[model samples]
Target: MDPVKRHLPPLKTSINKYNLHAKKSLGQHFLLDPMINQQIIALAGDIKNKTLVEVGPGPGGLTRALLDSPARCVIGVEVDQRALLLLNELKEYYPERFKIVEHDALKLDLTTLCDSPRQIISNLPYNIGTTLFLGWLKQGAAWDRMTLMFQQEVAERICAAPNTEFYGRLSVIAQWVANCAIVKRIPPGAFSPPPKVYSAVVNVVPKSEQPSPILFKAMETVTAAAFGQRRKMLKGALKTIDGVNLLAKANIDGTRRAETLNISEFDQLARLYAQNNNL
Candidate 1:
């Protein structure tokens, strides 16, 4: 079915009416371009029957665009009282389909916000984007897919390959649990108050097979230790943290640097650590 086109009040009007400005302290760089936002919606794929949880819908720019999509419901979770006030207009426009929740995205339990088979689509606030993405990854299959915006460097890191400069703990952790890709890049100009770096939209679909809770923690511990001193060989980097024994058990070479290790090696290290520690 085609998305129903609803005429929304011009986003500018909401900005002026509410005396709104992008709050720097909140890392708010609102996406004001309809074309770009529609591009993000397209990257999210068929949301006709899907619920979308938007992280920070400042002045309802992307929120309005999302409403125009065929998505069954679009829940805009905003922290700023001013932005929530402006979003109330959207709630009135699509009474049943649109809703606003005033909560900090960082601390809010996103899983409780919607029923099963939901997608998280958002132009996330820069301050909390990485933290929120990592949290979702740790939760494992809580949402169907995540189509989210992050600073260019972060997007690269999430999808970076094992041997690249961008590859690190984030790359291993995200890739181990999902198929990640950078679907679109938005220049700084697209935002209300342009951020210093470019922004990109990434799509992450969680893999069916993930490390067990104990094993996942082991992976976190292993990655933290290895990447904490990424310049050093695994042997030297992990020395204080039982690196030699863990690498030997995982069948990984102690001479390799953390950036050189593949995801499978990391998984092995996690498993071995769990086994050795009786986790």
Candidate 2:
């Protein structure tokens, strides 16, 4: 057995001993499957000397896997006070390497806490997964890569293609600045308090070269107006933003709906929108 495992009890044992049942209010579906946990960590690529930042690590199932790996350290952002107590016990096994911050992942600026050559791997709290992901993408190469878990439906939306049913503002914005792919699918049963929907892990690597903040903000605005009324053509859906004029400037067909437009087209539209509005 690894020396660390000898010191720290398994995650299930710790959970039962602490009576830390999953909390629905916190979206706490504990990842009890060790195999799944290890697999998710593997998707982050090598962590030999890399920092691993895990979010919402309730009961520390995935946290244990990260400790066992050759990672230089594991920094867990946990909101549940009960989970932090359990995680605190891990400090004994890896006194210098494991640290827990009792803070809400959403409110914390994760990038500022660690240095580069880091990777974030987590079975995220379902309620805030997408919002956190969008925030992370905006960090502009703060970390090397991100391997995150989300609902199966959300996973498809992240990696969806143009004209597909799953494609929308999320697909456009996510793909614009990052290379996203579905790493694996995890059934609902994998989680201790299984979520109603199946889960899937996604790998997101942000592009080293990204558009300026103004262009990105413009993209966000354009996608919101475009996909806000997805069924309507560009002319009617984008009327508030001068949709027909914007489309003509971008050399795109005004008859097309938001779902039919690709990321490149959206990028062009955002640039034109910014220029037109002098934004």
Candidate 3:
């Protein structure tokens, strides 16, 4: 037996002990397969002593796996009351190695939650997965890397290429800030209660140089307006953000559609937008 990894009760037993049925409202789908956890951490890169952040660790299946890893510390960000009892057991067993932050991952200030050399690895709750991802993208490269689970469709959107059908504002924003890709496709049967849709694991590592808050906000505004009307030409789609002047400043033809523009073109527009706004 691996002495470091405490042999905890099986997920079903513990889950039954805690009466932790998967909650639909919370998008709860507890992962029981240990192999999946290994693949996720592998994609997280070298976590020898890094702080590993797990969001929505319902029933503590993933949590136990993280603590068992060679990581220096594991923090579980959980908001559900019922799961707290189960996770509390983990905190007791791995007192020095485990910590629990009982707050909504979406509302919590993650920068204040952990130190540097941290990576977020979570089977994120479906409803707030994208919101959490967007927030992380906004925060720039605070973390070393992130391996997260999202509905398969959302995963494709994150890693989608320019001019592709899946590409949109999310694709632009995520690609602009980080190196994102779908590392694995997990089946619904992997969870205790199978979800109707398949889930995918995405790995994100922020780019070396990230956009400043001003420039990022500019990108958000421009992308929203541009992709907001996908079929319209840039001159027409970005009209709300002074498209004509913005395109002229960026020295780009205004006849192109949003999906046709790549990351560099978007960056130019964002920089010009920031300058125009006196930001």
Tens digit of per-residue lDDT, candidate 2, span 137-242: 7885687889999999999999999989899989999999999999899998988888899999999988988878888899999999999998899988999999
Give the range of the ten consecutive residues with the poorest summed lDDT in model 2.
2-11
**For candidate 2, what is the lDDT?**
0.88
**Per-model tally of clashing residue pairs:** 0, 0, 0
Per-candidate TM equals: 0.96, 0.97, 0.97
Residues 189-261, candidate 1: write the lDDT tens digits. Answer: 9988888999999999999986677888988998999999888999999887798998787788999999999
Regions of model 1 farther than 4 Å from truth: 1-7
* Candidate No. with top lDDT: 3
lDDT of 3 by residue, 1-279 (tens): 765454766777888898999999998888889888778778778889999989999998788778878999999999999999899976877899998999988888788878898888899999899999999888877989899999999999999998898999999999999999898999999987899989999999999998888889999998999999998999999898889999998888999999989999999998888888898
Error of 3 at 225 (Å): 0.6
Q: List the residue pairs that clash in candidate 2.
A: none
lDDT of 3: 0.89
**Model 2: lDDT of residue 106:** 88
lDDT for residue 86 in candidate 1, whole number 0-100:
91
Question: Per-candidate RMSD vs. true structure?
Answer: 1.9, 1.1, 1.3
